[model samples]
Target: MAESNKHLPRLLCLHGGGTSAMIFKIQTRRLQWALRSTFKFVFVDGPFTSGAGPGVLPAFAGCDPYFRWLNPESQTAEQDQRRVRQLLSKVIKDDGGEFVGVLGFSQGARLTAGLLADQEEQNAAEGMPNWKFGVMLCGSFPPLSLSFAKMPSTKPSQGTDEHGETREPDEDEIIHVPSVLVRGTLDPHGEKGRRLVKYFDPETAIAMVFKMGHHLPGAAGDTTSDKGDTQKIVDAILKVYADHLPYEELKAPKTTVMENRNGQLSA
Candidate 1:
C-alpha cells in the first residue's frame, strides 16, 4: 500500500469460491494496474476453507490455500452473513478508512449482493459500512436462505388510479447504489447473472457483457491488439464512482458512455 494511495477512495475486493485474495489479485492484475492510481483496493480472504467438491480440484490445483464465504452444506446463510459482518467491522475499525465501494467475482459477487441487500435493512446497525457502489462479475442472486429475496422493495408505486385505488407497488428487491454487472456471453451462469442484475433498479445498474467465458479476462488473455477486457471493467467501475459516488475530487476518466443492450453492454 503506497502512501499516496492512502488518500484515494478504497474498494473492498472479494474473491470467488476456491480462490484466495492472492489468486484474485493475480486474476485482476490488469484491472488493478489501470485503476491503481485512482482507487485503493483492499482484498480480503473468505471465511471458509476450500472443500472437496466439483470444480474445487481444478480451481485450486496448485493453490495450497483457497477460501469461500460459506459452505451451504455445513453452514447456514445467517451464519455466513454474521461472519462477513464481523470481518467487515474489523476491517473498518483497523484500516482507518471508509470503503466507497466493493468489487467481487463469481461466488464473491453473490456475497456482495447479499451484503448490500442486508445493509439496506441494517444500515442503522452498529459496525456496518454503507457502500456507495458495487461491481459484480459473473454474479448470481444469493440463495433464498440469504434473505435477499425477502427484502422490501424501496420503490413505491406512483399516484392512485382513476378510482382512487392506489396501485400496487412493485415488490422487487432494490439495491440503492450505482452498480456495474459484468457477465460473459458464453458463461453458463449468464441467465442467473441477468436475473440478479434485473433485481436491482435498472436506472442505477449498468450491465456489461464480453464474448469470453467464466474467467475474468485480462491483458494476459488479450488477443485483439486493443484495450483488454479488464480495462473495460475498470472503466465501468470508475464511471460508477464518478457519476454516483460522493467523492468530490475523484474525476471520471473520459470514455464513451456504455449503453445497456440486450441486458448487457459489450466490452
Candidate 2:
C-alpha cells in the first residue's frame, strides 16, 4: 500500500550528448512504484545535437558554443544548469522536498558535476540548488571547475596536460559532496570516470563497473545481461548512501527506506 507522502525522491537526471530526457521513459519505470514514491525522477536534456533518435531539443540543437563533457566549458555548464533549474522549478521548486540528488549520464554526468560547482558557491547571489548529493554515470569532469566560470561572461580557458600538450582543464574543483559514480567495465570511459570519485568527497564517492558498454542494458528500465545482471547496482548505491543525509525524516528523505525488495523491481 502506497502511503500518502510515499512519493519518490526528486531526482534531477541529465541526459547524454545529442540526447534528451525522453530516453529514460523506458529505463526508469522499474523504479516508479517500487521506490515507493521515494524516487521523483527529473529528466533534463543536453544543449547539443547528436544522431541518436528522440532527437535533441531545440534549445540545445543551436548552441553557438559547446564541448561534449571533459571539456570544461563553464559557460556551457552554467547555461545547462540554469536550464535544468528552470525546468525543475515547476516540480521541485517551492522546495517540493526531498531532492535526492542529480544523476547524469555521459555528457549529462559532466553537467551534473558542473551543477554542484554552481550550488557550492560561497556567494550564491546566483540561484543554485542547495542539493543533497549527486550521481555520475559513465562520465567525468575537467578542472578550473566553476559552474558559471566558463559562462560567456567569464569564459574559462582550456587546460593542458602534464606533457605541455593542451589538454582539457582540471575537473577537481567542480564538486563538493559524497557522490557515487557508475561505469561499465567494458565502457570506454570507465577508468577516468572512476578517478572523479577522488575529486569529490573520497569518503562518499564510489564507483561500480558492469559487464557492459556505455549504456546500462534494458529495453526499458530493465537491466538485462545475456549472461546475467547485477541488478544490485542501484540498491548497492542506495545502501552506501545510508548515513550521509542532511535532511530530516519528513523534510529530507533517505534512500535506504526505498528497498529493491527481491533485489529486482517489477513493471
Candidate 3:
C-alpha cells in the first residue's frame, strides 16, 4: 500500500544548548510518538560544539559532542544571528518540505523565538518562507532581533546585551505567529520564560506552566503527571496547527511532504 500519511506537515525540531540532534530525538521520542499522526518531526543539530548544558548530566552522560547555536563569549549577537539565518536557510532548502512550524527547547527555544522574529521583520521581505507556528519549551532570555543595528565602535555594547538578566522585548520584536510556550515552575529560567511570553502576541500565544525544572515534560525523573503535561503540549501544538494552517492546504501533496530528505541529524 502507499504511505498512509505522506502529507503530514513538517515540524522542525531544534535541540537545546549542549545537546545533539541524536540526544534530542531520544529526549522527544515519546512526544514524537504522541504526535506521529499529525506531524513529521525533523531533528537537526546546532553548529557550535560546547560543553553540556544545565540538567543534561547524570542521565544523558557520555552523550558527547554536544553543541550550541551561539557562543556569546566569542561572537556578537549580530554575528550569531547571521550564522543562525544561514543555518536555517540551508536546513529549509535541503529538506524541501512544507515547514509548518518548529519545536525547540531551552537555547533552541530562544533561537526559535528569534527565528520567528526574523521571519516576520526581515526574511519575509526576501521571499523566505514563514513558519505557521512555533513551540518553545522551557525557553529563557528574550530573542535577539536579526535586524539589530550595528554597534558603535566607541560603545561596542550599544545595541546588544550578551548577558541580559532582565532584558525586555522592543515593540517590533513582538512575534505575531501562533506559539505554544511551555514553562517549568521549578526551572531557574522560569522567570525569564515569563518575560519571554511578552515577546509574543497574546492573542495567538498559549502559555503552559508546569511544575518541573528546566527540561522537557516527562524527561529524566519526571513525575507521573509527565504524561498529562506532555499531552497538554501535544494538544496545544495541534491547536496552533489548526488555527494557523488551513486543512486543505495542509493536505496539499505539493507542499506538505518532504522531498528526498529523511529526518536526520542535519547540522
Candidate 4:
C-alpha cells in the first residue's frame, strides 16, 4: 500500500505548537494509513523551540525538543511576523511548485487558516501558489496578527491608526479553497473552532465534530467509535478531492464508503 502511494500528490502537514514533525508524524500515523492510497504527507517543524503543548505529554514523553511557530512571549510583533513569513516561503519552495494540500492540528491548524487567508490576498505577481485545500483539525480562532498579516488595512494610514493596530480582513479576504474542518466535541476550543470556520468559504467548507478531546479523532484508544469517526473524516476528504478534480480526471471511478451493520464506515 505504501509503495503504491509513493507517487501520489502530497499533503504538507503542520504539527501543533510544542510538537515536532517527528511527533506529528507518529500522532497522525493512523490517518496517514487511512489516506495512504490517496495522498502522501510531508511533515515540517516550526522554527522556534518550546515546551510541550496540551495533550502532548505522557503519550509523547521522551520526544523532547518541541517547537512553536510564534513566540507569544516576544515583545516585537513585527519580528515574529517576519520569521513566520520566512517559514511560509521556505515551505512553499520546498513543495516544488506542485498543487499540495495541507493538514494541521491545533496551533498548526490555526496557522493553516491564516496561510489560506494570506494566500487569498497575496498578488499573483508575488508568485506564491495557493494551497489546494486544507484539513484543519481542532484549530482555534486564528490570531488576527497572523491571519491578516499580508492583507491591506482598510483603515486610513496604511490600515493602522495612531494605535498601530492592523485592520481586520474584509469578507473578500476570507479563503474559498475546499476544506474539511474537524472539531472535537470535548475540546475547550470548540467555540473558537466554530469561529475559525468563518474565515473560510462556507460553501466549500465541511465541518465534522468528533466525540473526542483536543486530538485527532482516533487518537484516543482507536476504538470502534473512534475508527468510525476517522472513516467519516477520510470519506469527507476523498469526496472533496474527487469534487475538485478536473472533469477529464473524473472519468476514473470515484471511491465510495459503505456503512456496515456494526455502524462502521469503510472505503
- Model 4 C-alpha lDDT per residue in residues 186-226, reported as the tens digit of each score: 78776677667767775677777666778887675534236
Number of the top TM-score candidate: 3
Error of 4 at 163 (Å): 22
110-152 in candidate 3: lDDT tens per residue?
8888778777775541323678899998886666444454221
**Per-candidate TM-score against the hidden true structure:** 0.78, 0.62, 0.81, 0.79
- Looking at candidate 2, the ten consecutive residues that score lowest on lDDT are 257-266
Question: What residue pairs are clashing in model 3?
Answer: none
Superior by TM-score: candidate 2 or candidate 4: 4
Greater-TM-score candidate between 2 and 3: 3
Candidates ranked by lDDT, best first?
3, 4, 1, 2
Q: Provide backbone clash counts, one per model.
A: 0, 22, 0, 0
Alpha-carbon RMSD to native, per candidate = 7.3, 8.2, 8.9, 6.1
Q: Give lDDT tens digits, candidate 2, residues 1-267.
A: 334543656677776665556664334444443444456666644444445422233434543233232323444555554554455555455546566677777767766776666566552214345666777777754322333444423535465344222333345354556566766666666555655545565445555555566665442322534323334445544554544644454342233221133323222
Candidate 4 similarity to native, TM-score:
0.79
TM-score of 2: 0.62
Which candidate should be chosen as best, given lDDT against the real structure? 3
Distance from true position, residue 67, model 3, in Å?
Answer: 0.4
Task: Rank the models by TM-score, top first.
Answer: 3, 4, 1, 2
Could you tell which candidate, 1 or 4, scores higher by TM-score?
4
